[model samples]
Every structure is written in structure tokens, then in C-alpha cells.
Target: MKDDCPWFLGYSGGKDSSALLKLVIIALSELTSYHKEITVIYCDTGVENPVITDYVYQTFENLKSECLKLCLPIKYKIAVPKLDDRFFVKVIGRGYPTPTNIFRWCTDKMRINPVKQIIDVHPKATVLLGIRNGESKQRDRTISKHSKSEYYLSQSGSKRNQIFSPIINHSIKDIWSTLKFNNFPKSIDSQKLGELYKDAGSECPVYRELPGKSCGSSRFGCWTCTVVRKDKSISKMIENGYSQLTYLHEFRNWIAEFRDNTEYRCAQRRNGQIGLGPITLEGRKVILDKLLDVELKSGIALLQKEELIRIKELWQSDLKNPNYIEKTAHSRVVKVKTHPKPPI
Candidate 1:
């Protein structure tokens, strides 16, 4: 309240973020005066797990109304990746392979970059996160490295902005207790959240300034995540009665397998080198066809109309200038003469 800089709160609609949001709202309500503006931001990656996505959208609507009733100075914003950077646009549109641990490119483009774009505009802004000390060993180490004090930490890759984690020291038990007991907003349904977590596990971070585990490890992550060998989270959810996820789970498994088949990939790299490259145009079409089938079966809009338009445009461009080059393993490099140095 004493600070004049704006605050951005990262909310992932998971337990930790829910608890942090509840605490922040209660604290704000008790205060008689407001010194700075606070924007609660949620990154909607479009490929988020359907079950959690629905919960988050509903919660957002409810939170808005509830905040208005209490007359709290809170703003809500849903940040999304640019059209070109979206999952389907890159894969089906550009023939990029599904992310693997070695070539994982999804998180930065889809999740972190969108949020960072918002925060970078306000260099002095303070970000509020739901990070806790005991979440994981890697997470604990990150916290220790970046710790400025008990409650504050230095924002990664920034000199001015700072990270303020109110629930930095909260235990798993304490997190649930906070959500259950601090019922000020009423939008955060602890019971529903608990049920969601019954089959699910940890959540993906909305902002990835501090690296630890990848998003594919979480049930609340993208449905198309293929970094993990087995998407146990969605599989368990299906067993626990989320039958709608069956088609998505199947598609995810199929794509991971499809990505490994040599017949579908180019023999040359996109940069004109001799190596296994992106999926071929025919392979991309096959994947798209399967995805459309999944969308029909599951009654979910996996790809937007605009995304379809963009995909077609990219296909036309790729037809004109192919993404791969016809290079052989024994191809020799052409040496070029270097320019003469400028006289001193």
C-alpha cells in the first residue's frame, strides 16, 4: 500500500494462486485507502486443459461481479499469445514438430512471453506470484537464489521490477487451509478445486521467469503437451470420469508417436542443412485432419477460425518457398572470401 508502483498478480486458477488471490483481496478490502493499482492477470494459452479452462473462465466472471459488489480496486486481464505464436498456428500451420524435452519451444512463446510483454511495459511494476518454498527441490533452490528478503525476490532478467510472493513460505496444508477458510471472494470454490486436484497434480506456471519443471508435468497444463513420455494426468482424469478428455488424450498420444516416424519428416533441415527437419506438408495435413476429427468428436473448438485462415496462408507461402532444402549428408560447404579490414 505504501508503494506507488503498479502491481500485477499472476493467477493460474490453481490452488496456490487461489490462496494468494484470496489473501490479497481480503487485505485490500481491509485497507481504507489504495495507493497503487493491481491487475490480476491470467494467461489463457488456448491449449489449456479443458476441465481447468472452463473452471478458470467461470471463476473470472464470478470474481468480476464479486469484486464490484465489494468495491475493491482490482482489475482482471486475460493475456494470450499472439496469433502467430499460438500452438496450432506453429504446428499445423508451419509444420513444426510437437515439443520434446530437447526442443521444447512452447512455454516461452505461449506462456511467458505474453505475460512478459505486459510487465515489461511497466519496468517499475511489482509482480505478485503464488510461489512457495517447499513446492519442489528445484523451485526451492530458485527461490533461495532470487530471494531479496522473506517476502520479496528479484525479478529475473530485470533490474527495476521486483517479485513479491505473499505465500512464499506456505506449506501444502496451509495453502488448502487458506483457500478453504479465506472465503471473501466466494469465486474460488475450494471444494471444486479439491475435486479437480483429486486426479490432477501441480499446475503450470503462468510466467516462467524462474525455470524448474516443465508445464507438461502438470495436469493443469496444455492438453497437447508431449514432453512427458506418458500424460498420466489426463489419463487419470479420464478414469476419474472426465470422459470428454478421452479424444484429446488419444490425439496427444498419437501426435507424439506420429512425430517420431521418419516418413513424415523432411530429410533436410529448414536452414538448408542435412538433418531431420520439421514435419512434411502431407504430415501436417494428416495431423490437422486428425485434430479436426477430435474437435468434432469432443465438441471443442481446438482451432479458431482465424487460426485456420492463418494456417492456409502459411501453407500457400510454404508451397512457394519450401521449408526444407535438398541437401545430402556428404554435401561440401562453399567457402567465401572475407572482406578486407577497414584502415585504422
Candidate 2:
């Protein structure tokens, strides 16, 4: 028999998500006849580290294939934002500045909105989030607020969708205990994930920053993230022998540098405030050129073909507009190491 309410687990290829995935499987497995569907959704932000991206796909594939062989009623897919809403298009085509902590717009447009759409379509579904109390005080508060019920309801249109967090109050030690008890998905590196957490480092619009500490060894976010003073994850990865990510670190730094330079930004904000708006046309082009060069050298397609196509179209359209202006361009070269093969 099928349960009326399906479970939607959000997997971000991180430690919390991995542990949550294991718990969900163990729970379902215990109820041998539980035939209702469980869907796992992965939001690929296109700008993810190539190595991380590869791991995510490979792991998901292994899980899917294994589930089929085991005859487990599980379904999974990678969710992607529309082409126009993708990271590269918004930056190069729309000339939007890279996201910052003050006005971090990418989370809503590229990550949350797509998942919201899923919720709207799948009524009565319980979305499983992998949030742990040890991560932040804000998270602790959210868990406390929702503690009264096993299923926390969300208003999506006319229907009420439920939110469930199995490990909301779990500390790092508690989480490891559960993982040790359950049979983890084959692709997950349980030992490495545990060690990474020992070293250092989302929800209803999760504050990118945690409560007590700033980002450290566990910050596995976009290589292009400029919201903080630095993206220590990519830096750590490079130091740990992932030399391929060195160019990304430099590219992200360049974006931060360019944003601070008045010459590469608009004279006025969209609201006419005495501040910058989108990045200048010339600067956007420079970024695109450098990105393409990196793609060629690294042997991995950095920006999608559709993003480039739309960027060219948008650039042309912007040129025809009388209000648009072009700033001076500068010559530069991006340095990158060659990868033996694409990180597929």
C-alpha cells in the first residue's frame, strides 16, 4: 500500500544531506512494505566546482541504479533553473554583479524558486531538509519553532505542504552515530565526510552565514561565491591537491576586485541611489572571455552553450537600446592548469 504523503529530500552533496539521505533510507527500509514514493532533488547551480559536480552526478547515478536493482520505490532527478535564470546568464547577459551577502539574489532565483515550483506541483508532500542544530543558532530556533509536530505545514497556494527534519536537533557526534548505524548510499565517502566535518564548516531562505563561526574547511559552496571576505572551501581544496580549482579562486577574486572598482560598475543604482547597479558591459565581456579561456584549458565546459547564446543575444539587444552605454575595455589573460580529461 502507498502512503498518501510522499517525501522530498533535498540533497546538496554535502555532509548533512548525506547523513539525512541515509536516515531516510533506513527508515523506509525498516517499513519493508512501505511502497509510497520518495523523491530526492538536487539543485545544480551550474557554477559548482567541476570535481564536486562530477561526484554528485556519479553518486546519484549509483543510488538510482542500486535502487532499481533492489526494487526500492525511490525517484530522483537534478533540478535546474531556467536558462535565463542561470548564474552565468544573469552575470554576463544581464550584467548583474556577482551576489554579495547584502543583496544575495542567486539563492532565490537559482535555488529556492525551482524547489518551490516542485512543492506547488506536488501537493501534500513533506520536504525533508538536512539541517543540524550544531550549525547555527538561527537553525536551532527554526527547529525549536517546529518541534511540536512531526510534520510542519507550509502554505503553498491553496494546499498546505509539510516540512520534515529528522536530524534537526542532532549534534555532530549524534549525526555520526546515526550514520554509523545505517547503511549509507554506495557513492558516499562516509569516512572522508566525517573527517571534513571534524576539520571545520540552507532552508526557508537560509542565512548563508551560520551563527557562531564564519566559513572554514566545510564551506562547500560555489567557487564564485563573493558574499564573504573569501571562499575558504575552494582555497582549501586547492591546497589539498585539487590544483584544477586554482583558476576558479583567481577568477572569483577578480570579480570581487572588479566590483569594488568604480570604473567597472554603473554610476547609479536602479533606484537612483548614489551607488552602483549592474556591472558595466565591458567588464561583463571580460568575464565571459576569461571564463571561456578557463573552459578550454581545464577541459570542462564551465558555462553552458545556452548561456553563451543568450548572452550574445542580450548583448546585442542592450547595444540597440539608447539608454545603454559602454565603458572602456581592458586586456587581460586568465591562467589555468590543464586537466587530463573532462570531469564527467
Candidate 3:
């Protein structure tokens, strides 16, 4: 590795990312402090599971503090989407329909773009990840396309970077076993993972198990993902005793279910393309209402203060659109509480 070339690790807080994190830490620990130009980053979509968000925050603190004690240059960073591009702003403010596989507009905004932007800042560097062959057939195929050279140049029109994966050939068992032999305090809760696996009952999901379906016994993707048919992984956590997250799961499911109801959407898209879109302003208020109620009941804020501020601004802006019809479409309110939020 080049002495000054920084390395960026993509962390998702799932098993694969956790393993990769440990591997990078171990590698950097072996090198002299002068050669340790490594940066580990997590792309936070803002709407991630509260448990996961909390875990990652604390874990980063721990890793940073430990590296400081060792006098190492390993740094931990978090990449977040721009405010207006955040998930809630796009959904409630702009009224984007819940993302489908065909319309996954959130991916680039919430995940990829932020990471790429980080890479672009370093002029040229190495990006590391935990992607492995046995994880999926498609992933394996993609990995095969790259050269076996120690490094592969990843570039864009404006910037160039390198990509490397030390654990490309590691199997599922190998990953777990390696961790067993070289564990640092685990980033995720082992007890919670065990509970999730037990809650999964008969079979366990592996890697990506189709949208809306649970991917594994203890997966940790964004809490707001509507792509999967069932966020079984998070649901399992709730079942196993993380009641605070239940309302989050409910809200996520509701958003997905609510997106397709023609009664709520505008007759045309923002571009007049005659397509499905976000619900009405009144409908959006209903979502906001439930979200607030959930926040009050769970004592965990689902929407950040900044997000609420943005949504309010968007609502006011929407009222000014040439298409705004206050009389018919904007007058509705939550006439009655839909469901009492569960006891905290």
C-alpha cells in the first residue's frame, strides 16, 4: 500500500461489515503508526434503526478512543445525505412514492453518492469493503470481472480511486470462524443477534432475500427501507424484546403500505409525467401526526427536529404550488387518532 494513500472502509453494521471492520483494525494495528492512513466511514441514511444508529455511534467512539490510546491515525467518519435529499423530505415534502426496485431513487442519494463524494475528496485512495463470493452469485460474478491484481482503479469523470477486498474468497463459515479467533468488542450486540436468530424460527434468511423480506437472522439495513416485502430482521428484534423499535417498524410498514393507495396521491407526478407520487398534503400530515405520536409514546424520536423543520417548510411551499387546491385536497386532517401507540 502507498504510504500516504488513505483507505476507506464501507460499514453497514451487519455481520459482513463488522468482520471487515475488525480486519481493517487488525491490519492497521500491525503497521507502524506512520503507515496508518486509514479512514473508516459509515453512510447513515438518517432513517436507520435506532438500535443500529446508537450502536454505530458508540462503536465509532470506542474505536476512535482506542486508536488514540495506541497513537494511530485510524479515523472513523459518518457520511450523511444532504438535508433536502433525506428520506423523509423526499417522501413527505416532495411526495415521492416509497421506493420500489425500479424506482430506487433513494439509493444514490442516501448511500452511494455520499460514499463516492468522500472518495473523491482524497484525490486517489483505496476503498475497502466486506463483500465476499459466497454472499451472492451476482456479487461473485461482479468480483470476477475485476483483475486479480492487488489493486483495481475505480474512477469517475472527475476523480479516481482504488478498490480492494481482502476477504473476497472467505466463506460464510470462514468469516464467522475468523472473527471467533480475532474478536474485538463486537460492534453489534451478540445477545440481540442471538435473539433475532432464535426468533427467525425454522429457517434463516441469507444476504439479500428479496425486497421487503428479511435478509438474515440479524440484519441491520436502514429502518425505513420499503424495498423488502417484510423487514423480518427488525421485526424479529422487536419480538425478542426491543419494544422501543416496534413503533419504528410500524411507521416504516405504514409508509410502504400507504404509498400505493391512489386516494392519497396526486393525479400526476411533479413533472406532469402522469405517474404515482407522494400523498396529498393532508395525507402527509396524517403521516406526520402518527410519527409524532409514536415519538411521544416510544420516547424515541423517529423524526429528527431538523427533519420536522424541513417537512414543515416543504408543506408551506407546497401550499404555494400553482397546483395547490386547498379546498378539496388540503383540508383533510386526522379526524381521530388512528391507533394508540403502544405503552412505552
Candidate with best lDDT = 1
> What is the TM-score of each predicted model, taking all chains together?
0.92, 0.84, 0.83
Local distance difference test scores for all models: 0.82, 0.66, 0.65
**TM-score ranking from best to worst?**
1, 2, 3
**Worst window of 10 by summed lDDT in candidate 3:** 201-210
Number of the top TM-score candidate: 1
For model 2, the superposed segments whose C-alpha errors exceed 4 Å read: 146-159, 192-218, 270-274, 325-344
Report the alpha-carbon TM-score of model 2 versus the true structure: 0.84
Clashing pairs in 1: none
Q: Lowest summed-lDDT stretch of 10 residues in model 2?
A: 335-344
lDDT of 2 by residue, 1-344 (tens): 44668778887777778888887776665675865678888877787667767777887888888778777778886777888888889988888888776767777677666766676577778777777765667646645655544444322233356666677667777777766666555656676565444333522222122233322123445667777677676777777777888777788888877767666666655454555666666667788889888777767678887888999888666655555543222212211122122211
Superposed on all Cα atoms, model 2 deviates from the true structure by an RMSD in Å of 7.2
lDDT at residue 142 of model 3 (Cα atoms): 55
Model 3 TM-score (2 dp)? 0.83
Better of 1 and 2 by TM-score: 1
